[model samples]
Target: MNLFADIRALVLDAITTLVTEGVLPDGLNTDAVTTEPPRDPAHGDMATNAAMVLAKPAGKKPRDIAEALAVKLADDPRVASAEVAGPGFLNLRLEPSVWQALPKAILGGGTAYGRSDMGKGEKVNIEYVSANPTGPMHVGHARGAIVGDAMASLLAYAGYDVTREYYINDGGAQVDVLARSVYLRYQEAHDLSVDWPEGSYPGDYLIPVGEALKDKVGDVWLEAPEKVWLPEVREFATAAMMALIRDDLAALGVHMDVFFSEKSLYGTGRIEAAIDALKEMGLIYWGVLPKPKGKAEEDWEEREQWLFKSTDFGDDEDRPVMKADGSWAYFAPDIAYHYDKVQRGFDLLINIFGADHGGYVKRLKAVVKALSQDRVPLDIKLIQLVKLFKNGAPFKMSKRAGTFITLRDLVDEVGADVARFHMLTRKSDATLDFDFDKVVEQSKENPVFYVQYAHARICSVLRKAGAEGIDVSDATLAAQDLSGMTHPAELHLAAKLAEWPRLVEIAARTHEPHRVATYLGELAADLHGLWNRGNDEPALRFLQDDPVATQSKIALARATAVVISAGLGILGVTPVEEMR
Candidate 1:
């Protein structure tokens, strides 16, 4: 039961009545009308812009329409008062019974209380954390993983059929480099002196791959030529690195539904087919691109090559699909990959990329648009950097990863729950500073702990009420008369609880999972505020002398806990029943 949505519907109904009764003109567009919380809660419970948005279109004064609409809205029993404020805005105060019944709605719905059907089961593919198969996932990948995973979960909760995917980069030159690095380690396993090259991977993680290769092949490839050994070693090393990466992601509680291969796009007719689809649309051509700007004249060269007309789709310049050497450019296979996704019939495609990939966004979108003929929408979210700190000092790099901090290192330090929750405290496009010292703190300053503590506090309340011989089950509390929950604090918390279903729909539509974390923090604050107030006011306490009053208060607390658990579940964080 979304009270805000219900109120907005009532407002719309009143506007329709006004139009039918000749108080307002016909054919007025009401799509711009909105109902939301008033800026200052003292003004009213909810506010609407119905009169402001419709006055000019209906050829009427804003105040005159607002006053007439107020009279109609006030006739409803649910609306205690509808007063025109600010030139034409309608501020509404709902009856206490509306807020009082919210707890029963929450208890009835449980964790599914905030689930929405906004997407209507549209198929959505979210691809993220497609880290290179040459190494373990680093800190940047961690942020993208959490954001994408949470987004998939959020969209699913909002009734989207979501598929979590990762695109493996094994077809690139990096995998060849990984093959050579593993060959050096294989030589080292044979007790031979191997000189490490400047571009070779020096991480100790590759040693095991080398040892495993030696054990399997038994010096057969030790004396083979580059052509014979390169493919075998590349295949072997890629598999091992992917396994390591899977372990790292599992450590951070991220699992993918699909792992697409970049190599699969090569040698197959897929690349040609994707380009042909664009060619049929007159988007592909053989032309010479102009020399790029800002480069030295000596570095610039004009060459006729196979190119895609990406400029027509709002890109800065046309992008090449093939080079002069007859080799596919980096963007060619990417276009083919996204074309494969479009062919699979996903209604929407979402790519979560690191901030460094900002330049690739426009070109990628252009290809998807040209291939899908604007039928499919692609949304690219760029995740900013994460700077780690400990004890007020910048954290150091990991030797195991050989360059940056590994995702496993982060999960080991803070655990999966803390890491996932903290990573979502900021938006995907905003830079985040993760301080180990601050995140694990038990104080209210730590949002994860504060929210979990609220849930734990509710559990403690239920236990206390149970020990006092009061029935505290959801079935019992839901049947109790909650009219005694008339205190302002009690009603405010219930009102906040009513916003969950609305917030879920908003977050899903915006494709922003951080809003869930933000709302959960606000809800936790309300729960904590009411719990603290009970210390001085005996009537506010959960366990009261009267069984009916006690059940009503416990019902409110349990409802709040239900929402907290549901929100944390979307974030892939486990809510604790008791804080240690």
Candidate 2:
């Protein structure tokens, strides 16, 4: 089903033949050989650089190797023509029958037409949306959730054993602030006056948590000291916020396989174990770091503390894991968490963080390399901020989240499908503008609607064919003769379908899910292009005077729909059967 790969193998076979015939040298490396779509469509259907790359190594002229390779390639039944272009590049044209039979192959494969086994079942761990459980999930966390969840799905489709994970930042000063904030609301439940203080969460989302706490321990800790109430309140408030966070993720269709607690790493010797591993590798040390630039030496407190040699792995300077006060730095627990992941036997580790964490990337990668002794690879993706707009003005959301717009707010404003699709329309590293007006527009300018419309149009075609009593079943259409589908427009759409499997491997290999969004947009364009042409050319329409001949065209439409469903599934989007 991978047409490009099949053609590349054919080129290699011809190269081998030339080696045996003494036309080319033996032991020539064909590993660099590749067959890809030609730069210009007028050149040919496909092009190869086998002769150009092998010419110098084989001690042969480029044109000589190309001429010999071309003659050998012409013998294949699949290749209609092989022409030698400038500088010994070989451009190929496949038989029209190859494109004509694509619909049958696509229908046979269904949504799995582009699924790949590229990863060989390697275990991968993707950690994302590790937002603090202080309030409801916000728009930034939503971006991380969609990107990470979609990445896990894409990797799974490419035959990787993927685990979705969330790391909770509960063991921190912020949790203490959240605990105190809930206490204020608890006092309000008791009808007591409380003063508003700085560094306390003012979100009304904590009101319910406070009321629930009062119900559980009615007036028992009403005037208790901080020592007695802080711990219990911290634990209770964190649990409540996590519950709310889970509900928020559920509303957006994202669920994690694991929810790791930062508190778990404390008092468990896990941090020590991770640090010891680095020490054993000579990557951990106690030393005074050089005074930072732009700061006067008198103002800097140069202290010797336990440090990680992040510079060895390209960090600008060594990073301290434990400050002189014997308290763990923010990066300390992260090292232990990643070490735990390595111990779990994951072959690859991926993290999605906010763009502001750019400075932490190299150090994080260094620690994972040190802990795993370079056996494990870590990839970190940074998600930029999202700007929301409506009617060319900044859109304001409800006060449900208090200060920031919550994930639930975004989903409510434009259902989960539109939110998820529009979030990925741009790359993760780029700032995305989520305009309420533009995304919900039913016009072709809206990519999500455009793609969904393509699928819905296909469904309409199938239903109409069924209503007319035409046998449009896959079995019937797949068996119909398609040689009569010789129009340039029909063949163009089929050629696009042939690129699906190849596109899957590229996107999965690069760890980029935005490419799936990009590909779907292009595929929809081709399908719509073919559909639009049918308006002027009556012969190009799917439904013809002859139901039997119409079956072949319907098969092509079905194939396009099948691929669209598969792509959207990876993005965690439901394909629309009909647009309202």
Candidate 3:
């Protein structure tokens, strides 16, 4: 049903025929050949670089190869005409029936119109939103969560076995600070005077945790010293924070398949095992690192430390695995976490990190490469910051989250659908501005609303036709005679529909879910454009004079809705059947 792919196969077949006839060299590599929509739509329906890619290898001039290939392509019934463009590019105008039959293909596929098998069921592990279990997830975490979730969905749609994962940062000084903060809250719950220290978390979100702690063990930790209460309170507080984080993610429709604890890596010999695996490969060593740039010699101290030879595998410099205090560095646990992922037998690994973690990418990749022995590939996508706006002014931060707006705050301000759709409007690496005023607007300026409206409008059309006793069932519409669909506007929409499968493969391969949003916007625009055109040209209307003609037109509208539904489903957005 992929017209572009079908045509590309035809182009390859023609090249094969040429080689068999000895018109071209026998061993010319045609892997570089590509067929795509021409940059200028006026030129042709599709364009290919088959001739240009083969000319030099075949020992022939570009024009000669193109002219010969054009004749071979023009002989096919699907190709209306094949003309050689400026050099060796072959522009093809497909038969009108090819585009006209696309609605039938869409109806045949239903919402699975653009589903692909490009991934071949390869296992892909996507780790994202590994926010510390010390607090609720903030806006930056929301961006990474949405991106990773959408990417997992996209890959699943393209036939990858995807597992969404989250790494909990619960094994550090931060958890201890969380415990102390909760201890203060526990004292406050007992009506005792407490001074909130500088390093302790002061947010009121921990009030419930403190109350729960008091309820769990009444007055036992009240008179205890730091050593006795720290461990028990740390474990309790970490679990409560994780529960809060889970709720925050649920509110935004994000759920993880696995929640890996950094603390689990400790006391389990997992970190040591990961490091030992690297050491066996001659990558781990004890060495003195050069003083960091931009620091004075007097301010810097030279010390021998355990290090990973990350520079051997593309990092800017070797990275330390242990600190001077004889405790593991932050990178040490991360290495073990990734090694666990590799040992889990995943074919690919993807990590969605905040833009602030840019410097950690190279070392992380190097560690995974050394651990997996280059068998598994790791891709890290860094999501940039999100600035919120409301009523033409910057939105204020949430008091509950203390330093930033919580994901719950965002989901409350705008529904989960709006939040998810707006988060994907920009690429992961680009800064995104979420404006409340613009996103919820019912006009074409809002992409989510516009795309949803197209689906809803199609539903309205179907309902109206059904009420009028037009028999608008898919079976009836799919069998209608669509030969009369000859208008340029009608064919243009079908052309757009033909690109859905191609778009799916491109977006999945690039690991870019923003491309799906962009394609949906374009598809919505085309549907809206044709709907408006019907106002002037009565013949372009979906409801026509002849019953079969009306069925054909409705088929096209239903097909557009079908593709829109599929695209929105991949984005994890519910397709609205009716606009409010």
Candidate 4:
């Protein structure tokens, strides 16, 4: 359950009662009221601006409103104290019993402890790692995959019906290039000497696809020209590359709910339908764009082109939907893809694109806005570059991926769990430096290990308690007198656990998965702090002389473990039952 929401409801009910009794004005909007964690823990457990926001509207001093609100709030059993602080901010101190009951709530909720219904089951489509199906996914794609997949998970946890999708860029000329590259590999598989040209994909990964092609067509396509083999070979090669990509994603624990084909947009009337949707709004026209700023005027083309009036919708300029040669431009298919998402009845659309696609963001957002008539919101998260290092030096590229390090290579070096956790340690917009040696190092510098170590430490404690014949099961722990957990160190951990539901709402609403990583790190720090305290004071240890005391201490430790597991589950990382 969301304790913060419950407190806010209590605060609102008190305000409404105040209005009904004519103690305050009848119509002060309560929408602006929000309950949040105090900026400083020293201030209070929770802070609200209800009095401050209503002061001017009610034609009363903020302190007057806060003083009146405090009395009503303190009457609630959950609120230990409500004091007016600063400029009418109400600081709330919840009772120790409320914090003591958190572990019981965690145990009762299991992995669903912090799950929220904020999104109210709205449909959300998240498109990510739509890299060209030319080869296996690389390091850049890995970041997008983790970010997208984690986002989907986060939204689902927040009660949004999320669809994890990958868009196959198989309709473009890039697939034709891939077909030619595979054809060269096919010749080499037949024992013919081959040289990979500049634009061809030259990787050992394609060697097997080449062998598969030989087994399929035998000598028929072997002797044929590009006219006879290009179509069949392109189809075969695209399928092979997609298989490799799927396998790469599988290795990292990513499974797409849908793999939308870009080729389907080409043959179907979808593109026309999407364009017509925009055109009906008077957003389509034939026009000449202003010369791009800072470029040579001599190279600027003033020729008229079929363009979408994207400028009206906040684009820098009206963008071309059709090239001069009458073929659909790259943006055309993209608009159709988004239109397809909107047509699927999704209430929200999210795209996880690489940093290189930053320029495409505004136009694509405009497209979704026009297609959905501003009824749907589109959020695009740009994943910046990930720089890899080995032994404090730059990591070399993987030959298997042709030009970059493959996701498989990273996962193989550091298992999927580590890869996913480390990838999200940084914000999606910030460039990340991933060091292979540092990530796997069993130290505080390695956040993945730090958090996992905390979980494993709790497991170690539970095992020790079990051997000592102390019943540490949930049923027993729930019955423990947690009020005995009064040590400052123990209380600190309970405070961290109390923030879980609030943190989930913030991270989910912001669509920022990095917040989860940061919260886990903080939680681990609190867990470690308590463990260190136990080393100094034996009474703080999980295994006390008294079974009841041990259960009380272990209950808190197990509650921390429960929250960590729940957070990691949302990140698609398996929690370590024990550190190896």
Candidate 5:
């Protein structure tokens, strides 16, 4: 089904034949040989650097090997022509029938045409959007959620067993501040004068949590001291915030398989166990770290503390595990959390962090390497900022979220599909501008609308063909004669469809789901381009005077729809059936 892959196999077979005929030496390593789309389409349909890679090893000139291999490749029915370009590159132009058959393949396979088994069912755990359980999820967290969710879906399409996770950062001073903020709201509910402090969150979102606290305990905790009320209020507030966060994620169609609480690491021996495992490997030590860069010398304080020998694993410096106060440092719990994931037998670990967490990436990787003894690999993707704009101006904060824009607010303005699609228009590490007007605009420049329009247009085509008394069923269309589809416009679309399986494997391998979005945009453009050209050339239209010819064209349109649906599935987006 993968034409590029099939063609590459043909190339390898030809190389094997060259070896058998004694034209090429035996024991030549062909692993470096690759067959891919030529950088310039004019060069040919597919190009390989086989001759360039093997000439020196085979003790032959590059041009001599390329010319010899060209003859063998041209002998195949699939290859229309093979030319030796430049000094050694072999460019092959496949028979038009090769691309013409893609529509049949797409119709037969449906959305499963591009699915890959590259991961081999390897278990992968991806932790993302682990915002603190102190407030509603902001737009920043929305980017992480979309990227992480899309990545999980992408890996799954590539045959990886993926588990989505969210780490609850509840065991910190911020949650304590959240508890005090809720207390103020609780007092306000009781008609008592409450002073708003500097460090407390004063968002209106917490008002409901405060009222709930008042209804639960009445006046029981009204007279209780700080020590007595702090723990209970903290637990209550944290749970309420978590509930709100869950609702926000649900609105955006994001769901986590696991919600790990940082509090669970404390008083549970998990942190100590992870550290001890590293200690047994002689990675744990006591040391004083130097003053860090980007800080004034006077602001730097030196103290001896327990450190992890992360530098041994190529980290810039050894990281501290415990403070001088004997309490676990900030990095200790994270190490333990990832260590626990590695011990659970996950083949791969991925963390989706914010741009601010870029500095933490190296140390986290080092610890996972040491903990897993280099058996498990850890990958961290840092999502950059999302800048929101509307009406040619920067968007303001959300009153519902108190200080910043919430995920729900964004979804309310634009539906989940638009938000998800727009968020992934750029790479995760690149700063993305989310223009409300542009995202909802029904123009080709707006990729979200453009891609969706292509799917909807294909649906329209199917409807019209069905109304004309043609058998538009998938089985009927797939069985049509595709040899009539030799137009350049039709062939161009088929060629793009052939790239789907390869694109999925590439995106999955690089841990970049944005590539799927990019491919979908390009595919949509090609589909649209073909449709627009039909205005002048009546033969290029989907519906024609001949039922047999019409069915063949519909088969191509339906095939395009299938790939579009599959691509959107990886992006966690619903394919549009009709345009509004």
Candidate 6:
């Protein structure tokens, strides 16, 4: 249960009682009231702003109200003490039983311990890793994939119906380059030497695609003109590239629920319909944009081009939907794709884009606002660049990828779990330095290893207890007398455990999965801190000479392990059962 929520209800109930008993005037708005962990833990378990927020509105002094409220709250069995702190902030101390019951709640809830009803089962569509379908995914795409997948998992745990999606950029000019690159590979497969000229993809990853094409056709298109082979080859090569991308994603434990093809936007009335919808809302018009502000400006030509009234919805300027040549601009298909998502009846939409796409955010949000009439909210998370390093220097580029570090290379170097966890250790908006040596280091400073070591430490303790015939399983330890677990250091762990459910809600509400990672790090630190303490103080040791005491202490440590496993499950990281 959410103790903070329960306490807030108690405060609200007391306020309602005060109003009904004529202690306060009627019609006082309590919307601004909040209950949260105080800035200093010594103040109390929680602090409420009910009196402070209601003082001016109720035409009463905050201290006067807080004094009365404190007495009322302290009378409840759940509240051990209530003090009116500075400026009438009500600080609350909960009974020790409240903190002691946390482990039981964790055991009962299992993986659902931190799950929230915040979204109320609302449908959310998350689109990420929509890299150009020209080659295998690279390091940059890995970050987007992990963030998006973890976010989807977080939202789902928070009670949102989430759909993980990928939008293939097959309709762009990049795919045309991909087609020509594959043609060269096809020619090579036919024993003809071909030069991969500038502007062509020279990655050896496509070598197999070329061979596959030859295997399927068997020289049928060997002597054909461009018209005879380009169309079929383009389709064939695009499929092959998508397959390679899927395999790369699979290697990192990412799976998409939907794969939307950009090419589908063409040869259909979808783009026209999306533009028409905007037009009906008076958001579509014909316009010309200004030239570059700083750089050498191109010849400023006044031309009538189809544009969206994005400025009305907070864009820098009106965005183009159709070019003067009657072909759709790049933004046209994106708008149509988001429109399709809206029509599919999602309550929320999230797009994970590379940091370079920061400029596109406003226009995209504007289109969603204009089309969905502000019903569906869109949030764009920009993933910053990942700088890879090895041996204290920059890692060399992948010869297979030709110019960038492919996702497979990173996964092969470090397993999928490490790649995913390390990618999320930094905030999505912050540039991350992926030091190959540091992340894999077996020290407390390494987050991935540190967290995993906490889990492994618990495992080691359990094994030690078992070998000594202490019977330290969950069933045995849970049955032990835990009344001796009253030390401040021990109780402090329970206090941190109490924050997990609230932290999950906060992270999910803000659409920041990195918060979960940060929380996990803190939890692991606290666990390790307690473990290290046991070394200096034998009384703090988890496995004591007495089986009963050992069971109680082991119960506490195992509970920490359970919570860590649960948090890692949300992050899609596999907890290490042992530290090798």
Task: For each candidate, give its TM-score against the true structure.
Answer: 0.98, 0.97, 0.98, 0.97, 0.98, 0.96
Candidate with maximal lDDT: 5
User: CA lDDT of each candidate?
Assistant: 0.92, 0.91, 0.91, 0.91, 0.93, 0.89
lDDT of 6 by residue, 123-217 (tens): 99999999998998999999999999999998998899999999999898888889989989988999998988899998999899999999999
Residue-wise C-alpha lDDT for candidate 3, range 1-580, written one tens digit per residue: 7888899999999989988988998988878888899999999999999988888878898888889899999999999999998978899999989988999878876767888899999999999999989888888899899999999999999999999999998988999999999999999889999998897888989999999999999999889999999999999999999999999999989999999999999999999999899989999899999988999999999999999999998998999999878899889998999999999999999999999999999999999988999999999999999988989899867989677789999999889999998899999999999898898999999998999999999999889888778998877777877888899998999999999999999999999999999999999999999999999999999888776777889999999988988888888899999998
For model 4, the local distance difference test gives 0.91
Tens digit per residue, CA lDDT, model 2, 1-580? 7899999999999988888888888898788899988899788888999989999999988888888988988899888999999889999988999998889988876766888888999999999999999999889899989999999999999989999999999989999999999999999889899886987888889888889999999999997998899999999999999999999999989999999999999999999999888888888898999999999978999899999999998789999999989998888998999999999999999999999989889999988888888899999999999998889998766598667889998998899989888888888999999898899999999999999999999999899989999998887888889999898888888888888888888888888899999989999999899999999998888888889878988999998999999999999999999989
- Candidate 2: worst-modelled 10 consecutive residues by lDDT: 395-404
Error (Å) of candidate 3 at residue 91 is 1.0
Model 5 off-target regions past 4 Å? 294-298
Tell me the lDDT of model 2 at 81: 91
TM-score, model 3 to reference:
0.98
lDDT of 2: 0.91
Tell me the TM-score of model 5.
0.98
lDDT for residue 317 in candidate 2, whole number 0-100: 94
Q: What is the C-alpha lDDT profile of model 1 across 127-215, one tens digit per residue? A: 99999999888888999999999999999999999999999999989999999999999988888889998888989899998899999
Better of 1 and 6 by lDDT: 1
Native-to-model Cα distance after best TM-score fit, residue 478 in candidate 5, in Å: 0.6
